[model samples]
Target: MVAFSTDTSPLPKTKKSLQLGNYGTLMSSQEMPEEYWTPLKLPPEKRVTSSRSDLTSVATDNLSELLDETIAEEQTTIDRVFAFLGFTANPFSSYADDVCNNKASDMRLSMLSNISAAYNAVSISMALDIMQDLYETTSKDKSLCSSALIAGMIVGQLAGGAIGDILGRHMAMAVVMSLQIVGALITACAIQSSFSIYAFIAIWRLILGIGCGGVYPLAATITAESNDDTKDGGKAVALTFSMQGIGYLLPPILTALLARFVPLRLLWRIILGFGAIPGLWLMVLRLKNQIARTNSQVYKSKRNMLTNAREVPVNVLEAIYVEPDLFRKMIGTGGCWFLFDVLFYGNVLFQPIVLSAAFGQAETVQRGAIDSAVVSLLALPGYFASIIAMGHQSPRFIQSQGFLMMAILYGSIGVFFQHLSRHKFALVLLYGGTFFFSNYGPNATTYVLPSLTFSSSCRSTLNGICAACGKAGALIGSMVFVFAASKFGEDIVLLACAVVSLIGMVVTICCVSETVIHDEQIKKPEVRMRVVISEPSLLDYFETA
Candidate 1:
């Protein structure tokens, strides 16, 4: 994200020679010799006359020849500079991996994605606080309105995923992130702009939701494509996805911190507006260096376009019909996400209410903050452990186990709610256990599996579909959790979540197959270079008479 710097420190002219290719190769041992240097010179010419038409033609031909030679030399010089930096003059040549695989850049992209995920959830926790200020609304209405934000996000996700596949992941991310910032700014200005709070907030939230929806496909696909092997690729992506836990954790920690210094009235605005800051920073980073920059050339190449045009589905609907096996797999992946999010978001978004019900609603803010912080802290280890496990274990196995553990935990929590509520420590352990399995299991795997399930041409499209399905579950979960809990009590909500988890476990075990991509298998589809140029493709770098 930082600008490439020029070395301003003085150096001996002899040492200033460019180093070419790998670490050991040097372009020169000494300063250029006067004889080796070419200087542009032209021979004196006589003006052509009417009687000397043949001479005139000869002079004109000589001038044209000299101009061509000069231009060729200039092009050769530029080629030498490019080659020294590991670029090719031959447009047909596939780029070298060294030019493409930047570990630091990839990690930075992951960090940006983490920020995006974090911002997406932060708004959920702050929704009730925002609604209270804008209007006097009951908790159920507030919760329903909040679900609309995530609904907008789902709509955005479907669009973003399709955009990534059709246009390019980088371009899609750029557009998504830009709109997220605008959404945040607009939300912040809702009061100042004098627009109806409901309409304005809803419109802005939708924009924010779109940005959030795009993040999964763009981040997951770009990381998968960038790394290209199950072991390293899986770990790289899991590491990126795990940052969402930190995102989940931050809202409570930040709210707790801000609550001490800021008044409640102004706090909601700050929280809503603050979401934009991360997106803005990430947008700047993405602009400087995009996710998977090297793939852009391959995506645009004539051969690749023709090949992809025939092989890759233009959209998920087309993909479902054209590639039946892929469609079935998409169903498994998307279904798992749907079931998991029904449990995950239901628990996560309404953690405060659940805690209030358990501990009694006194000091709601402090209790919610304390409980959220504790649960989130417990979740971190799971995210990291999953990152390590992703390298050694099968994603399907991990995901299935997670779902099973969560189902057990959810059932236990629901059955023993009265008994556990009497004992704070026991309740915390049960709550923390669910959070742990959620990350180590389906939550992380859902993101990774979708990226791997489909071909490169349709990876984002299918991922988007899978993710959109998950968001649909989240929207439903968020909407129903408040009403269901109020009408039927928290026990029923917990039991339903447990049922959802059990279903997810079954779906994962039966439908979701292990993603078995290897390095060699992945390499074939990527633009592969048959040769690595050791020196610049210029006449000066070659032996000549």
Candidate 2:
């Protein structure tokens, strides 16, 4: 019912050339006679009907406008949340040596690393219990069912990188963590209800794997970007990744405690359900702390927020395709990751079964839990050792050494399984040594290298691709190990893993480069400067001519 006016005053007369109305005529304002002037007039206004359909249309229009406004407000809130997480606020911020070396930045990255580790380890931890309870009793294809988690993870990791690029890392992480929470809750329910237990658990595990997969690249990339400026940037990144050791170490100890104190039947459900806690906490913190305060200040104006948002094109394909060199690097990094995980995840996921074989299936839950805990604990020192030595070592060297050592250890165990198993201490030492080397070398470096090699534009995607390759390898390895261990025996499986590690070592030496953290190479390009040229003078014009 708002009204609009269409009235206007005549323009003041021109001094000499007065414009005649669209007639290609000109007149002198001073010479033009007063009798020739005309007064301004407007047509009579008509009253329009406010019919029912018209009212309905107006109401609909008003509702649509209100909805649009609401959506805009919601989007602004989300942008602010992303800004708080430090992702969207400053698209062109420096990520040089000085910037990456900040104490605050390192701390934030460390927290993120820990959360990522916990998220990833959840499925593995649950796998241990599933092997004891459901796998043994269930009628379904246990290996295939168990491998579903890893398969889900592979898909999720690939999706996560693309999502991170398109949506921004903070937002992608939030969505990922939320998915993990949902997956965990569903898994807990499946455990509690006995109906179609194997199928339900397998489906839920896949969902959980997706969330875990999403964490890998994001955590590695964020940690690498944060620590890129420091002299110990690699050390910092390695330390952050080594947080996964703590994650691996926790489940056995937790399971041991639960077995001793709680009801035996409730243990698996409790373990599966507990994964939601850290994920929920992390998702909250990630959203809340996304953008830095300086970035928030810089982007206080709405125009700046819009501008910042536009700066980074969120197209994953464009990011990779635009830079062919980056895609080439992706092959090396992704390939190495694929090979490493074949050995690492394959062995780690089935470690409990290996232990059951070692100690006998008749071994009580508490003893099994304690022994697993003790063995898992053995990998921790290697992680800290890597952190200590990362500043001194090159990634290429560390990976090569780790892979070589793992091959040696695994080969020994495979070739002399009966001889080593006769001496329990020797067998444990060899098994734990493989873990130590894996953590110190390829496992840590694979995570760190991808972060440093690519431009920030496609770092997440590249990292995700690498991690997804690893998970795909994991899926293959897990399935292969189960089949091989059953048909060919554990010794052959171990030998196969040893061969895989050897292949990884060769790949590292031939394909992957020694990462050089050059500030200029990694830093986002500077905005182009437009030089203003002076107007041409007669001499300048003649000289040019």
Candidate 3:
């Protein structure tokens, strides 16, 4: 036990105000009277029990005493605590008091920390549309667009993870968003000029991929840090991920609406350009809120680790190698995500082509119209279903069931596709049915599993890596599906996907634990405190006993 004696005779006090870095205020130290410093004393019986209480109580009592002394030394400490609590209560109001007041400023800072998460679903969905345009423009040149986009995604994810760790989430997001804005502008310009179209699209896509990839880790890190309750953090992350459906929905809707007014070639450009709008808004919010302070601890720790190491400091790659358990878990989850992305992206990207093949050669505009409506409608229910189902089921159970269902559905579709004729309503029903099951399984699981597998410290890095692997699968699917369809037929490609889906289902069931259920089962112990002293003071010691 630690002890300190309070001096009843007051020392000469300085009136100078104290400034706190987090709150951004100058507060007076003379608010509490000198009498508040009367020696904290307890009777002899209580002094004997202090050592036996739980560790948490001892720590809390020690902390309270430290706080009391600090308050006596500087009266503004209580004011700071009150300011902090106020900021914690309501974070989103934009009134001047809310922005400028110390508590409000802290709240706004926390809000900014999480803003990147808010836009992730939108960015990912927009990237898919951009890839679609690239494929459409280069019909004969499929690999160029697919390879470039996939490579961009991989590189961006790696860079984003690294930079996010080094620079802090806000700065990293700002840099990435700036790059995205530039990429969007360049991509839009490239649509107008066909010269070096492949190279131009490739470069822009790579840049945009980096920004998109960077935001995922940044958002994950921010959410982990800002959230006090782990369950709330999980739910918040789950909700953010659920927005991927929104991202998935946006491009097609935008394409459908704008394709009529704009040229098809220019339509994607406008859509891609629109991708920068959210990023720009995020940048502005980050600047206004000054989120750098919340991010400082992470940055400082990373800096010290790098500077103080006698040996070559372990980078993410090295860390993964060192921590094989984490690596395996990440890889397992990532593999499941990969399978999901392949099937999901393959189905989405090739729906028009598949419909056209199923229906036979038809008017291009008519085909586009029918395919667009079918894809759009099928997606809406799946998104809503995902949101509802995500909350009710454990990620492991949902993902496992989803993969099994997807496999069964895809297999059924493959068998039925051969019998269905072009323009038949049954074909649309079959296709839509398959689409609905796609979200039920892998699509929803990929997003939820990452939040569960890792601790808060490395959640973003692990999630980003998993997301990159999923993109890799999408890339492979993009290339393989086109080539396989041209050679073996779409039915064969889908049958293969069904097999892969089953493998994922088995893997998920066998390997992944249900995090939500498991976390709830592990109870945190409650702690109580007992403070003791040999002598009694004028005031009675207020013990919770």
Candidate 4:
């Protein structure tokens, strides 16, 4: 028979104070408080001598029984807690244990499903073509169309950014997707209506643009925050961005299909009406999966504090300005995007004119063939290269290098285009090179950089501001490209883009830092140093003592 020894011992009390000392300086004993120390009392017991073999067997049996009972109780407690929280206890409940054991295949599948669902609204290029038609029909004036489109872009980005902040990312995305559906319907109806169809289209486009802009920031924020690894976040974001390339590729194919099968006038209406399908589907999925995949955890703590507390909440502008370092970084990074937009959009908009001069303005199927083939082929390489680079390089590096390369390429075009004897193959090579490098650099940079730098809480707003700046740059670029081409020709306009690209390169080099690596350390020592130095009392003491 096994014998049990019953012993009673008092549990030790926790220490009330701790002493900390550096170098030879002695911290006060009173401050440390010796009274906090309570030694554990040993159990008073008389040992009964027994054979070693019997004692070992008895101890092992007792230890196994104790562990078994403890594990059972722990499992019972866990189940109760999970029940209270309304969470289903499944294999996924041990996500961390599974991850550690390299068994996260289900998690991976879930993430992929979420990504596919989120990125279903891939209609950017189709939307652009549809918008062009709306503007042309409504305004009958090219400049007004351009201006309205620019304004719409800016308004959409700013509103989207702000809305994403006020509401959660999921809510913002759902709202925008709903708006997109409405905008599409209104635009389709407005086209057929007799009353100022142009104004109606412009207004609807503005609403559509707002929704589109919101999607970018919200998607980026969600992708970055949801992933377990930063590298995974980058890959997820890159995949979403790759959809823009899909949109770019799809439209030309769509346009070609429409041209071959459908009438040109009906094409715009079909595109506009069809654009809502993806958005509506995404909205439904978002609603259905709201409980499982929402990014509420990211903002919940900050939001709870804001709601429960009496302290005044800082306005967006006030919060930004208060942190001057952050403000400068945002402005500088945003400025690079601004410059990138000018060069990128300017070149894209004026490509027809440049190609017309090189290949001759025939407006024939041959001309269309050459133009489509060249642009499509050039864009394909650039887009794929960007996706590949997203995983391997820092966004800042890609952006800065892209700007510098674009500046050089554009500047060279001015010098080289004049000398080339309008050889079709040679011109294609030059144009393709420009398109390839531009996508590789600025296009990828603009999208990637905004997603990387800002804190999750403020990312949407900052990205919105960056997007607004980008549109402003596009507006400037379009006006300049048109003006310069009219006054001096393509050479002058290309040269101007080169200068803007150079400025963009400079801004990126000076301001942006790599955000791919998670900086576990505080935001930068300089920011804190400046904060301390700026205090009046600190400055006064430094000057005197």
Candidate 5:
């Protein structure tokens, strides 16, 4: 186990290079982001079990000694100042700006990452209405489609996170996007083919889920690294993330519009295939302009494979042993995320049930789609609201406030369920509030925090673990919601959600315990980080020379 340290000395000028402990890198401060020395404010950790992997825990005692010694010798004054200043970033990093000097290229790269961040919601939201055919035809379980997708996401995410750490974020992203497109087309084709369509759909949907889940951690990592420089940077990232609010609305809006003209069966296939568009367009954009590389040395993926492959577990342990309070941070980040998803997905997966309770059955898909769209309208503003709120408020504030508000809303609804039910419009608006607060609160912040908080080498991996916790929550919520509704009615379930949200608020306050109110609010989460080094991040992260 590594001991906690407070050393942050600059590297020796005579010694041109020092091998980063356990990371196997020999980069100097000269190899770091130019802004590392150029007046960019510093940054932001936790612990739990050292075994994040199944591999038997290797002793990190030597690794910890190596870490303390390396940190004492290599960390620059800027890193120390960063820690001293509470790890807050300036409004813009000259280093980040240098990475993509071309305005058009920068915007395209940002947009692509944003699309990646937002599309997971679209993948699932678009298909929910159509997948009902399984239950209708075979008298099978209704949640099969979502469950398959969620399950796929869990597996894909775990694998993708490790892959991102071992390979690179860019490569990992490309592979997942490819999987998403392939999964979409294959699912679409399955319906059109004469084969056992359910089997194919389920299998491909799992594939699609894997793709969707994998991208989320990557998106958050890319966006935060690229944009964590300024308040506007956070705003820009949050705005794109807000697109998820619109993502939830998009499918139903399209369905509402298209269901009038297209056949339901054919329309469903089109919707399934529609998942490919964002990933496809983003891939094309990357291939076209080509993002510039900023590092002095190009990554030799083949040469480093053996080196990086084994480090994933090492980094996971590094986070546990080296980073102060990392265990607690994981608990806070993962726990709050788990709780949020329980409510968020439960509500999302069962929107029809709620609507049916209020307005009777949708009677037709088109009517139901329109109703869904109307409620989702509130969510659009809610997402943008976070962009604005993030510019001024701490994510911790937003997260805690959001959970409390959600609890109040859910409890109020539960207490007066019959009254709200009698007033259908009131119930819909109240329901819509939950979606709004979700995006504005934990939803956006959860995406925001992990990217900015973790060490760059394991950033994607940690984000993956946290995001997987969220999907786990989503899976649990989706699974139990229908059964719980049958047993105790929606009112009891609403009260339970209220309680869960309260637990989330408590998790946010205690687990993510670092609180530093600053202008650059979101960039710093771990102000008291015990172990830090300015190593090259695995993504295309350095400035272009």
Candidate 6:
């Protein structure tokens, strides 16, 4: 076994203009971003505290400003609905796909924040071999140690979901990022001369895992929710997740460059310590905009826990139960993610093993390093292609297409194993296709779909659940590749991957929606008219200032 250790390490809210629930036909407006997924649906009536007297009592300036914004918001809603109905151009590309990036720095920052997860992997990949010797651990112990990191990440993802919904995205991001720095440093310093060192290392890796895993949902949802511009509506979100490709290549490149000069013991420490730098920088950058600005669309779209709780179920279970379609979507997204990670992690962790067998083992360190870097590099195009594809196709279409292509590719490799194995170049081409389709297909879509599918109130929570399932699949993929390769040989393992890919295709076709805009608009269009308002709720845009 090549020792599977380091792989796949991969950010809101507001109070309201209190006393504003369905004032008559007043559903939510475009101000509430969750409503942005589709046309605003007029909500059913609730408590009505607003009367003619109360309206007159309010200041004229406040009322006038509120009405102006509301009218503008309703107008935006009207545009989106007409666009959805094909009466106008797309809301995103209406003026020929002008990107909104110049205006969305906070969102772009949230997208880059996910790059920190890649740093966590670097520490483990660089330290693994050195620690095996220093700790005098058995191969079993080494594998277990790495598993500790993955386990921590898995648990952290689950908890992070609830924390995100409960505390808001920015706060949760800041908290977890601080924890990551502490965990990385502690793990770097775990170089004592005793068996206890192994225990110490494992504990800290687990801690780091929690921080790393928590970033997935927080960063992804932040970008997805904050994104307001793109000729291709989902391109921003796709770019956000595509950063993972750069993350995977970073550790090996760093290790290769540093190994020549640094002392072995000191080298591992430096590598692990380095993971904290990106997190520190990002934390400070994020704090500068700790909360979204009041006048911004990003701010208006927030899901308020204090004032909007009555409308947004804090508990995901309650939300799903109230709307069974949510339950079905949860299954679809979760299942596709689960299946994709199984294939992705399996292929990435074992690539070196397969490459050596096909190309013949490299006789020199330089050659081996080059091979590793090349394999990682090949996956980048797929990530880049997915961003472009997102501009034109629905996630449902992209995901299903990717899965079907992968199934065919894996199946072809399996059936012609003997012939392809003999032709090293042909086998290499086939192998690279897997990474291409994986990134282009379900890998990016799994993350993108959940962020857009659910309402802001439960977005992080739902996306967290979906992402955590991917981690669970990671554990299974890493283990399965080992057992199947050992027991049935590599050829059979490839065939089995094809089978899994086929199942993923089926699940995606049945479960995933065609597009974020159309499905949501057709299902729940926003409705608005001043009915009665209850003091229990406030207008989302009304700030005391």
Best by lDDT: 6
Segments of candidate 5 deviating more than 4 angstroms: 1-136, 139-142, 192-195, 290-320, 357-360, 514-545
The better candidate by TM-score, 2 or 6, is: 6
Worst lDDT 10-window in candidate 3: 536-545
| lDDT, each prediction | 0.64, 0.62, 0.54, 0.54, 0.62, 0.65
Could you tell me the TM-score of candidate 2?
Answer: 0.68
Q: Which candidate order results from sorting by TM-score in descending order?
A: 6, 1, 5, 2, 4, 3
Q: Once model 3 is optimally superposed onto the true structure by TM-score, how far is the C-alpha of residue 477 displaced, in angstroms?
A: 2.4
* Alpha carbon lDDT at 471, candidate 6: 89
| Candidate 3 segments exceeding 4 Å error | 1-143, 191-194, 228-230, 262-268, 285-324, 345-350, 357-370, 516-545
TM of each candidate vs. truth: 0.70, 0.68, 0.63, 0.65, 0.69, 0.71
TM-score pick, better of 1 and 5? 1
Candidate 5 per-residue lDDT over residues 1-545, each given as its tens digit? 12121133343222123222323322333244433222212221122233433111222343345445665676577556433423343222223232333222333443454454344445444455655653344434334555778888887777787677666665677677788888878877765355556666777788888877787777666566555554455555565466566556667787888888987677877777777777777655444423433222543431232122223433444543554456877887877888899987546644665677666777777887777777678677677677767757878889899899899888888788767757877777778888878877898888777766666656688788888999898878867876887898888888888999999998898877444322244242333222322232222222333
TM-score of the candidate numbered 6?
Answer: 0.71
How well is each residue in 421-495 modelled by candidate 2, as lDDT tens digits? Answer: 467677677877887898888888888888777766667787888888887877777677878888988888888
Q: Tell me the lDDT of candidate 1.
A: 0.64
Top TM-score hit: 6
Where in model 6 is the C-alpha error above 4 Å? 1-105, 133-135, 228-233, 284-316, 345-350, 358-368, 517-545
Evaluated against the true structure, the overall lDDT of model 3 is: 0.54
Q: What is the per-residue lDDT of model 4 for residues 331-430, given as tens digits with 9 covering 90 to 100?
A: 6657877877787765675577556756676353333544554566566677567656765777777777777777877777777767654666666666
**Residue-by-residue lDDT tens digits, candidate 1, 207-315:** 7777777887888887787667323667767878977887777666776778778777676677677777766665554443333433455423422222221223334
**195 in model 3: Cα distance from truth in Å?**
3.9
RMSD of 3: 13.5
Looking at model 4, the pairs that clash are 138-198, 156-210
**Per-residue lDDT of candidate 3, residues 480-526 (tens digit):** 88788889887887788789889888888776776542323333332
